[model samples]
Structure formats: C-alpha cells, structure tokens
Target: MADTVFFVTKASGKQEAFDLGKLQHSLKRAGAPPSAMPEIEEAVQKMLYPGISTREIYRKAFSLLRKASPHMAARYKLKKAIMELGPSGFPFEKYVGKLLDFEGYDTQVGKIVQGHCVPHEIDVIALKDEQHFMIECKYHSEQNRKCDVKIPLYIHARFLDVEKMWQQRPGHDHKFHQGWIVTNTRFTDAAIQYGNCAGLRLISWNYPRKESLKKRIDRSGLHPLTCLTTLTKKEKQQLLDQGLVLCRELHRDLNQLRSVGVSEARLKKVEQEVRLLCEPESPIL
Candidate 1:
C-alpha cells in the first residue's frame, strides 16, 4: 500500500523508511520510461519485507530496466559503476580528468607538485582561462561511507601549501586558484561546513544542490566505460587498465575491444550499445 510504512536496510547497516517517491525519481532520472513505472513499483512493493536491503531493491529495479532498455539500465548503474572504477582509484582520477577535458579544461591526473610545506600528489589539476584547480579525489568502494570533516581539513591544509607555491609561479599573479575535494559519496555536514568556511570547494555525489558530481556527468554525457552492461567485469577492468575509461573511447575505437579478444559478434553488440550510449540526447525544451 502507498500508505504502508516499511523500512529498508541501507548499506551502512542503518534502517530507514522506504519512500516510493525516491525510487520513482531515480528511475526517471535513469530515463526509465513512464509506462514501466507501475510495473516496477508494484513488483518492488510486493518484495518489501521488514528490512529489505536497498541493494536488493536496486537489483530488482535494474533487472527490470535492463529488460526495457540496457542503456537506461546502464545509466541507473552509474553510481555503482563509479565505485567499480577502483580499488586503486586511479581510473576515477583519470575519469575526472577526462570530464574536465571534455569541458575544454587542460587537465592532468596523478601529478606530483611541490607544496610550500612538502611535496603533495594532486589527484587532478585542471586549468582553463587563467583559472587553476587543485582537485583531490576521495574514492570509496562502499556506498554508505561519507567523507567526514577530517577529509576536508586535511585537503585544505595540503591545498594551502600547494597554492602558496603555485601563486608564486610566474604569470600567476592574477590567476584564480582553488582547492577542491571530489568524492563519489556524500559528505558529512561538518565536512561541508569546513570546506565552505575554508574556501575549499567540495563536490560530492549530491552536494552543492545543483552542481553535484552526478549532475556534471549527466550534463556532459561522459558516462564511464564501467557503465556499459555489454561488457563483463574483467573486460571493463582491462579497458580501464589500458586507459580507456569512457564509453566514448570504445565508440571511437572498437579495436580496444578486439585487443582484449572480444569476438566480432560480441564486439558488434558492444558497438551497438556504445552507439546508443554515446549518441547525444536532444535537449528538453
């Protein structure tokens, strides 16, 4: 019943009431067709128990969406796909660099820079139009982990050190510089507060209201290669290792798939999926 109160278990081991609105909203955002909503809602509701895991619910919705459109299912899988970007986090850093590059910013990933206090490894450095950003990526494999205040605290201190030296460089007298913390998870309230007070920009999965990381990815249409449902886990990891992080890369060169010994038939299916994924969507007017 829509009026029924049922709790769901989150990945963090916490239980909270499930809201159908949230589910429907996420489905819509994934481009799930309106016609499919009633069936998905009814099915998911039927499966609800005292403490059904959120992950299970997600799987049910994803399975249904895949049947309707694999591309849409891929979009729904974006969050988990991002987590799949690593145990090392390098792929995610490189992925962020690519997103910045798509926006016309010259970007570097995994660079060592000398800070005023010490040498620091910046996850990503983006420059455009006399503006410089020293970005530190905080990647978590777990969905429920939140970036706490200590993260922003440490990042701000490191950024201050790096910015000091950066500002001293020639031709940077008037350039604007900033320190940013980008994470795949949500930020703790304290963490966001510290970042705001310290002038460090914090970008999380849903933070900053309108300009969150998810929004940026959707706006840019730069879905990660891991989002493809057509590829197996090993195949995706192999491409990531070879520096192919975006679906656009595979679309541009199917040889990358072949290099991994993907048969011609499989490659054709992958190509079709890539084509659909990479095709630009018309703007909603």
Candidate 2:
C-alpha cells in the first residue's frame, strides 16, 4: 500500500491526515451496510488528494453511499443537511419543536409573550409533566461559527424577566420554568461554562459531549425533512413552507408529498428512506 498520503482540511481551517478507520466508524454509525464499506473506502482512496476539504470528501462519500443505501447516506449527512433547514433560524426552531413533540412534549414555536421588563419572542416552548422549557434556537448557516457566551447571557436575561413576570402574578409558580439554548453548531467554551454556571440547558451539535443535540435527535428518530436524499430542493421547500418539518411527519402523510407535486415514484422512494431513518434505535448517550 504505497499510495500517496493525503490530508483533509476541516471546517475550522485545520488540516489533518485522512484516516480510513475514522471514515469506517462514521459509516457504521450511519448504518451503512458492512458489505459496502470496502467498496466505499476504495472509491474514497481514489478521490483523495492533498488539501482536499473534508466537505468535499463527505460529498464524495455521500454520493457513493446513496447508490448502496440512500437511508445511510442521508443519515451520514445529517449534520450538514440540517444547515439547509433555513435562510433563518425559524425553520430550525420548528424542527426542534417537532423533535420535542416526539419526546412526548407539547411544543409551541415562534410565540410572543410579555415579560416583566419587555416582550420576548420565544423560539420554542416545550411543556411536559408540568415542566416548561423556553428554548432559544441558534441556527448557523456556516459550520465554522459557534454560539458564544453572549447568546446564553441574552437568553438567560430574557428568561429571568419572564420568570419575574410569572412570580409577580399571584398563583403563578416560577419553579416550572426552565431556559434552554440549542444550536445547530457547537458552542464556545465560555458559552458552555456560563450555561452550566447559570443553570441554563445548552444543547449543541457536539456540546454536552455525550448527550449532544445530534445524539438526542437520533435517539428520538426525529430527523428533519432535509435529511432525505429523495426530495428535490423545491419539494423540500414546499414541505417546509407547509410546516412539515420532520421526516416522520412527511412519512406519515404521503398525500402531502403528492399534494406538493412529488411524483408517485419519488414519493414511494422517499417513504422507504423515511421509514428506515426513523426506525426505533437503542437510546444514545
């Protein structure tokens, strides 16, 4: 094995040697078939070159995986595919609400409520078993950017104002309220520290290491519609605009796809992929 060694440029602009083992591990996590690994690896080797962006590598790998298993390819691309949820954070907020819904929570998105000091536009509000969570969803279009300390600080302040209002209103208990900040990307170290110190629930792509946002979503089998490879951009947007944010929602209602002009053949393919992607799995983290 005397092939040229290759390096990959990461989203952080850092470079590292490409490792076959790492790729294999990710493929396995994505539920790719064991029989297809060797072929995918060979293809990746043929595509590797010095200074290649990891994004390019991922795109190449996804293309190959789609041929063998569309479900696996979509799952493998989950992290990046989520970024396509919006030009704004609203879509991500709705998607998060849907995930919470899957977890047996009553969810509300984009609601405005009056605080003691000011009116706050909440991103997602999840209520279950008498506990309420006011979630602030921070969505970044670029992978390299992060949710910083200031975001949690702002969220905490708003939550506090709302809490004060609740306290002032006789018979309204404050113990039921909790503040959470969730992001599509990781958070800065200071942000995590502040969140922990302030008792705010912070969920990000890889933060809270073991119980990260990705792991939670995967465990709940609540992937966003963007994770499907079967839908075109127009089709996805149509569904998103219609508030069908989760794959499970789309899967449960095939007529929604048909109503949006998705062809019968493509609708069947999408349904199959959605079914596999949302299959019940053992708890993660």
Candidate 3:
C-alpha cells in the first residue's frame, strides 16, 4: 500500500491532519443526518498540503464546506476569526492580559457579550481587584494597515455605547473602568496624546523581533502589492498605516559600536571571522 499523506496547517505543524472525526461528530450532533458524514469525511481527508497557514486552512476548509452548506460555513468563519482575534491568539489582547496579571489584576481572558454595540462579537474585559478594564484590542501587522485608524473609531464607538450598556444598573458607570487600545507598533506621539484625551488608552507595546520579514519579502522580488497603487483613498490611508518590522536586535549594540577606530589588526580579525563562517563544519577529536 502507498504511504498516506496528511494535510497540515502551519499554526499546528507540518504533519497535522484535519480532524475528520470531529467534523463528522459535530455534523451529526447538529442534526446533520448520518448519511452526510461520509461525504464530509471524504472532503476533509482530501485537503492535502505540504505546509499551510492557519488562515489558509480556514479559507480552504470553509470553501470546501460552503459548497454543500453555506450557512454552517458562514458561521464557522465568524467563530474562527473571533478566536484568532481574541487574547489566546493575537498579541494585543494576549499582551494586555499578561501585563494585567503581572500587575496583580485578576483577569478573565475572553467574556462574550452580545450587544448592538459590539457587532464584532466580544470585548476582552479585565478586573484589577476592584476596578474593571474594558479593552478594545486591535492588532495590525506591517501586512495590513487598516487597524491603525479603525481602532480609534472603535474606541469612539465603545465610549458612546458605555452608558447604554450600564444605564440599567444605576450609577454603575465606574464598573467599566479604563479603555485600552493595545497594538504591536508605535504610533505618532500626537496620536497617542489624542487617544489619551479622548478616553481611549493607546497601549503601543513593541514586540521583540529577530529577522526582518520585509527584507525577506522584498528579496523574493514578488510585486505582490503592485496594484495597491490603485487602492481607494480610504484604502490607501489604511495601507500607509502598516509599518514594516525590522530588527532591533541589541539595544546595547548601537552604544557599544560608537565611533570605533578600525585598526589593520581589527580588519584582519573581521576577515578571519567571515572566513570561519564560510568554512565547513567538522567533527572534532
């Protein structure tokens, strides 16, 4: 018999396989007749890939399921996006929750509240002993810039809706404490000031990076964002907000490298180091 290959997602591992049994079980429990299981199983097991991203798996799986049942497919996408955006996955809420815990706050990761205010599903709430913290966390990497401004708009919306959420509880506005907009990249100092004054606490947390993914993408020579020039006015602004992540390897590297006078001996040492890097590995006695 030929060796069987399993489809895998990068979010999990290269050898991971899609859970056909779980899918079949869910379908059965949800009143999807037993006869439908075989087709779903066949469809799932056939999704083969050497390495696939979580997002790509989401896209592919939904596409497969949507062909047969569009409603369940739509529901699945919403649930997946929610989990990805929440504290367990994305950096914004993840970092915020960790920081709060470090600061002696009792924090609950994700608490879903259905309201006209949050069509986006849920907002991460934190309780610092007695005070409550309502954080509208949005994460945007250099790949997508839309969050830079959309985040501010979300803050405004939340502020406007706060009273409505608490109107029934009688002078309980303090129950919803501070608002935080946590992000990976830094913002203009001016934007920071504006956000603070507007009652939206912008927490720009810089993440440590090793290699530059931008340089990697650039080196690939793929004009992936070529047609981005034709983006609409709003879209262009959104695109500009996305900043590339480059190395900040050593804070001390810069201070230590200041105004060095290179001698002939130093030059030889540098060349020797380069040659050592080029040499093949050896088994030492």
Candidate 4:
C-alpha cells in the first residue's frame, strides 16, 4: 500500500488523510471474509477523490459487501439503517423498547403515567426484577445531529417530578425508579456532562465508547426492520407503519411481508438475511 494523499471528509465536516487500516478494521468488525478484503480495497482505491465524504466511502463499501455477503453488509450498515427508522421518533422508541425486551426486561412504549406535579408521557419504560427505568428516546435522522444538554435538563426535571409522586404514594417506597435518555445519534459533550452530574443515565450510538447503543443492539441481536436490504424503501416503511419494528419480529411473522405485497421469493431472501444478522454471535465494535 502506498501513502494515499487524498483526504476523506468525516460526518462532522472534518477532513483527514484516508487510512486503509480504518477501512479494514470496519470490514473485519462486520465479519467480512478475508478474501473479500483485497477486492473491497481495490474498489475503494479506484473511487478515491480528494475530500470524498466518509458516507460515500461507506456506501461504496456496503454495495460491494452486499454482493459478497448480505449478512456482513447488514452488520456494516447497522448505524445508517437505524437512521432510516425515522422521519419520526415513534418507530425508534418502539425499536428501543424491543431491544430492551431482548435484554430480558419487560418493556413498554408510549405510556402515560401520573407524576407528582404533573402527568407525564413516557417514551419507553422497562422493568426487571424490582427495578424500573423510564426512558426518553431521542432520534435524529441526520448523522451529525446530536442530543444536547437541554434535553437531559428537561428530562431530569420530569424525572424528579415523577420521583416525588412515587415517594409520596404508600407502599411505592420499596420500588426503585431511574431515568434514562437513549438516542440513536451521539450525545454532545455538555449533554454527557449534564447527565453525569445530574445522575441520569445517557445512552447514545457511540457514547461510552466500547459499550455503545450500536454495540448493545448488535450484542442482543435485536436489529430493527429497516436494516433489511432485500426490501425496498416503500416496503420497509410499510412494515414500520404496520408496527413491525424489530427484524426479529419480521422473522417471527414473515407473512407480514407477504401481506404487504413482497414477492414470495424476496420474502424468503429477507428471512434468511434477517436470521443471519440477528444471530447471537454477530460481531460489533
């Protein structure tokens, strides 16, 4: 490999020297075959341009990976596919609840509960053993957008209000409740700081570095239905609109796809891809 002087633009609008190691690492993380590496590298090299966006690089690599292995490609595209779950945040909230459900918690989405000072509408709530958590799901369609400090400030206030209500209610003194803010995109520095200072748990796509939201989703094998490449955009939206949020749900009831007019052949292809992507051992970074 030669020192390629070309620069690659990142999601945050910063440009840096194109690094092959980073590309190789991503492919390896996605479980791409060792043999496919050379071809992928060659395709990327041929398409290189000064200031090419990382998003474009990813799109090119994913296209090549799809031809090689749809399973690996789906794994690689997990983050972007999540962004595709929304023009709205409701589907993302439901998907988050499903991920929590897979992790052995009893989860509920879109519930209205009475707080001490006011009635609050919660996005997702999860209970396990004797502990319960009220979660606020923040979804962003743009990769660069982030959940900021103001979000946690407001959520923490609401949590305090609700906590007061819980404390005042008899017999509820034995129960523990926590506030969590979960997002599809990353959180800002100030947001993480505020969350930590206020004792509110913050979960974001890449926050906490090693154990990120993406890692959690991958580890649980609860990928959303939008991750499927076999289906067209319209078909994916149709499934989402029909309340099919998780890929595992679609896997369990594949007739849902058939009902939405996907060809029988394509339905089977989607089923196979979903199964492989949601398997227990899918790798994550």
Candidate 2: stretches off by over 4 Å: 1-5, 174-176, 281-285
As for lDDT, the candidate ahead, 1 or 3, is 1
Candidate ranking under lDDT, highest first, comes to 1, 4, 2, 3
Q: Which ten residues in a row have the lowest lDDT in candidate 2?
A: 166-175
Task: Arrange candidates, best TM-score first.
Answer: 1, 4, 2, 3
Which run of 10 residues does model 4 get worst, by summed lDDT? Answer: 276-285
Steric overlap count per candidate: 0, 0, 0, 0
* Cα lDDT of model 1 by residue, 231-271, tens digit: 99999989988988899998888999999888998888889
Q: Which is better, 1 or 3, measured by TM-score?
A: 1
Pull out the clashing pairs in model 2: none
lDDT of 4 at 106: 100
Q: How does candidate 2 score on lDDT?
A: 0.86
- For candidate 2, the per-residue lDDT at 117 reads 83
As for model 4, its CA RMSD to the true structure in angstroms is 1.7
Colliding pairs, model 1: none
lDDT for predicted candidate 3 compared with the true structure? 0.43
| TM-score per model over all chains | 0.95, 0.92, 0.36, 0.94
